[model samples]
Target: MKKTNYHTHTYRCGHANGNEEDMIQAAIDMGIEELGMCCHVPFPHYRKHLIRSLPSVRGVRSLLSLLKAIIKDGPNMRMPYRDMETHLELLSQYQKSYEDKIKIYKGFEAEGLSVYFDYYQKLLYEHKVDYLILGHHFHKHCISNDYFGKEKMTKKDIYLYCNDVEKALETNLFSYLAHPDLFLIGYNQFDLDVQTVSRRICQKAKDLNIPLEINAGGMRRGLKNINGEQLFLYPNAHFWDIASEVGNDVIIGFDAHDPSDFNDAMYNQMIKFAQDHRLHLIDHFDFLQGDFKKFQSEYDIR
Candidate 1:
């Protein structure tokens, strides 16, 4: 295990326990070499709204009710931009402080292209973000903030999700995808039709050179007292088996939401799984490392 965690979250969004410094310290303890945080974008009730509009998620009204039920932690909960800038500043500092042990990148766990495509295209150029990790939290067809598991997904919704899978790669806005199989819109566990959507998905990823995350967050869900409902990390073991067979740009991340999640127990088995399946890790991504230099030339202000 390389101890490189590319998928991470912080306190500013909602879940996740640590601030940037705490995450870096945990990464150091875990011997993590590269750490990336994919925090949520600000003012996302509308994003979730787009996901709900999809025919895939059932009980849309109830889902909106659930989101509306979100209790304000403090006074500024209503204002997302204020919180976003504060969080971005903290992200920048963490990168500077932990420059030695880990190469930290500015990023966000952005919603699908349906919601943020227009805004994200600008943010990618404007914020100089290093990468964008796909987080399919769509409630109607795939899992939503209100629901988990596959009870709501329909074949059409699955198709819609599959299309988004392609769109995430096509948006030309993200570097890697966090959990590609989170929703499993079109294919079954290992029953993926390579000629169909899976093949296209891999082909596009290869063509565009976008890497997908072999997230270890799913394994953490098995832990007791832990909240795994919406946080992505499950492997969809069979889905990855096929993805590894078809794609070479696969990457791995702990998808850690907190400092305590930096333990070996969280990632050891997944590393073995990725190795067994022959999935490519982010560290091995040649184009990304090289393109990053170019990306830096174009975007890095400092």
Candidate 2:
């Protein structure tokens, strides 16, 4: 398993546990050589008035309601992440702390929203972020904050989700797709409709030369049994089989939400699962490692 994970979260994300240093030490203990601290990037929420001139009271109420439903701990619960300046400063410290042992990269798990494209880009341009991973957590069709797994997914939902993912890939903004099969979270079955969308996603990733993540976070959450069958919502057996067939670049994302998640046993299990499926798993990605050097130079990151 090479001991590298780019899909890690921090305590500032509200739902995730542990501070950045805790996760860093955990990775070191697990013998990780590289760790990317991709904390959740802050997202902006628009007021109804800003978009359509709705009543002030109505706008506030609606925004609050939407935030409550979508944000696990609500809007004011956490900073979501340190501000860009602070984030970069922390990254410097973490890197210096483990200079000879592990490589730590600064990045964000950003939402793939056309509306927020400029916002994300601003971060990259102004903050010198190392990379951004595509995490289509919210449905962009309506720009709602509702997360993918919070609702029962229909084929229509699957279509919209995959479409958004494809759009994100087309932008060439992300280093890789985080939890590419996340649309399957609430979907219990791998029906023909699901298969169709999954195939489309894999093909698009192949076409774009974007790596799709086989996230291990779901394993930490455990498995779901549907129709007397043990199934995982993601790192989905069916999806990977299609990915293996499509010949898309695949990589493992620990999606570590906490320090404890950096366990060796869990890491080995996920790697074994990918090997069993014959999915193309690479230890590190050029875009994330070597290619990013060019990216940083282009952006004048240093």
What lDDT is reached at residue 123 by model 1? 63
Residue 7: error of model 1 in Å?
0.8
**The CA-based lDDT of model 1 is what?**
0.60
**What digit string (tens of lDDT, one per residue) describes model 1 on residues 1-302?**
35576777777655567887887788888787877776665544543443444444347765554345333422111124446667677778777877877787777776564545655555665664666666755533322432323544455555566677776666666677667666652233333442355566666777888887777766766532213332223566556666778765777777777889889876777677778788876563431221233334334343
| Pairs clashing within candidate 2 | none
lDDT of 2 at 38: 87
Give per-residue CA lDDT, model 2, range 6-31, as digits (tens): 88887776678888889999999999
lDDT of 2 at 25: 90
TM-score of each model, in listed order: 0.75, 0.83
